[model samples]
Target: MGALKTSKRSDLKNCLTKCKLFRTDVTGSRLYNQRA
Candidate 1:
């Protein structure tokens, strides 16, 4: 039970971070290309 709870929490955190990173990556590339 404890392991499952911890894993679930980490999974959610990873998901959030992944989403943020993906957004940043897309925007970053767009800005970089535009400014270049």
Candidate 2:
């Protein structure tokens, strides 16, 4: 049970990181387009 909990926590962290990266990518592209 403890191992399962740790694995789930890591997965959640990974998901959050991915989401943050995607958000940044989208915003960056928008800014770039506006400047062009």
Best by TM-score: 2
Error of 2 at 36 (Å): 0.9
lDDT for model 1, on a 0 to 1 scale? 1.00
TM-score of 1: 0.78
- Which residue pairs show backbone clashes in model 2? none
Error of 1 at 33 (Å): 1.6
Model 2 backbone overlap count: 0
The reply for model 2, stretches above 4 Å from the true place, is none
lDDT of 1 at 15: 100
Q: What digit string (tens of lDDT, one per residue) describes model 2 on residues 3-32?
A: 999999999999999999999999999999
Tens digits of per-residue lDDT for model 1 on 1-36?
A: 999999999999999999999999999999999999
Give each model a TM-score. 0.78, 0.95
RMSD per model, one decimal: 1.0, 0.4
What residue runs in model 1 are displaced by over 4 Å at the alpha carbon?
Answer: none
Cα-based lDDT at residue 27, candidate 1 = 100
